[model samples]
Target: MLWWVLGGAALLVVAVVVTGVVLFVVAAGKSDRVWGVDDVAVGECVTVSGEDEPVVRKVSCDSTDFHFAVALKADPGVCAAKNYSRLWFGEGDSSDSFGKWARDGLCLAHVYQQGRCYHLPSSKETNALADVREIDCSSPPATGAGENYEVESKVSGMPECSEEQAEYFTEKPTPTGYCLRLLE
Candidate 1:
């Protein structure tokens, strides 16, 4: 009888612990200021380098909010043929002639808006200022430039804003790339 009682107590404890963990995760997602479709601007343009030429595309938002949505184009019949079926936000092939990988991640594309460099999650965003807008890239990619792609998975966490915007937004709080939320 005592053995059965102990087993029940152990199970109860385990259940409570698991429940607590799940609750914490849900709370964290909510507290992270999880972004939504309303947080992004429609028809944002970004530049991507394909095998032959550089392609420009637009960004899209998801219903979940706080996700990355970018499409790319690659030259046909190239080693890095642009395909829309995989994750879109990542570093591309830009290695030194000597054979060293240049950037930590793929320089997927150049985001529009001067003085602001946007980075998707799975890339470096630590040095980026707090004012940098962090978008969620978990949504499917939006179509652009006659391609069907989606920005689904990301390797890193938090996208970064341009350095110039980091400064101006931090200093003047104008409608600069540096600023995220509007200043009162």
Candidate 2:
């Protein structure tokens, strides 16, 4: 009924360097900056991960200009961005996984560059920096055309039935493995 829208490694003895990035970039500035999950620090914000080459458009963390702080990060051998989706959808597969609901609530609109688009964070931007650019989540976007949607708070992973505590608490998955929803 409300709004609309929405790691790393250290090679010791002999390091191996690989170069071939697949990225899907989005920026609030005239030019977007490249960054990855690893580049993101704990408590910092970042674009949600998905199949689309990881997008790492940096935003100022000091300000309320972004969503989803860098709750977790992974390296090449550990897992792929798709794993981010797995971790997200499967309610996270392990003890050390990141909590999907662990995020700032002042701005709860899950605006995926105006809509939830990307699913798995890509490998390309996995090595990029993500602590610089500033995109204000509170301010009206520059385009001012995209829509925003409602976000349910108590809704846990794929709830089968609605509860009195959370009548609108619903959970669904996108093909790529994320979600876009609104009872608004």
Candidate 3:
């Protein structure tokens, strides 16, 4: 009877240890924070504009560690009032498309620096876009460096292109109806 009791206690301890380890692993896999537009404020660092929830991050106004910075936040009603120019998202070449956008509606974003040296955005998907190095618009860009847009504006509907911003517009509009417009 004494041996049996010791055996049972050892088994119980082992089970408890295994359960604890499993719980810790699961918790670690999940992010501690999830951010949304409502969670951020003006002048905060942000993934360009999109509806898709980005892969769980802690967004803050004080930090510039992220991609594009938010100068203004707009909805379907107010987005048009703030934008000066627009470039259609997904107009980028086949090399630029990460994956066929498979599912989920898309969002458009354009980067604009003060010097007007914005580059073509590689992806419309906020979570998928990689290595975006946004800089302050007040400053000038390098003599022959890459693209950087300071303020990101999520536009409404397929934007009308003009000589002022872009020479052409998106051939493929987003299923959601709105496309990202950026400086050329």
- Residue 174 of model 3 has an lDDT of 21
Q: Could you give candidate 1's per-residue lDDT for residues 1-184 as a string of tens digits?
A: 9999999999999999999999999887544221222222322322232332222233342223222233222222221233121112223453321122222212122222322223322222221111123233343233231211122222132335433322211111112122222111
User: lDDT of all the models against the reference?
Assistant: 0.29, 0.29, 0.38
Which TM-score value belongs to model 1? 0.22
Off by over 4 Å in 2: 1-34, 48-52, 62-66, 75-149, 152-181
Pick out the ten consecutive residues of candidate 1 with the lowest summed lDDT.
168-177
Name the TM-score of candidate 2. Answer: 0.27
lDDT of 3 at 40: 46
Give the Å error, residue 44, model 2: 1.0
Residue pairs clashing in model 3 are 87-181, 87-182, 108-180, 111-149, 112-149
What is the lDDT, from 0 to 100, of the residue 42 in candidate 2?
A: 46
Candidate 3 per-residue lDDT over residues 113-183, each given as its tens digit: 32323333334433344434454456635523334443322243454443334322222222111222342
Which regions of candidate 3 fall more than 4 Å away from where they truly are? 28-64, 67-96, 99-101, 108-128, 135-145, 149-184
Give the root-mean-square deviation of each candidate in angstroms.
17.0, 20.9, 11.2
The parts of candidate 1 lying over 4 Å away from their true place are 34-184
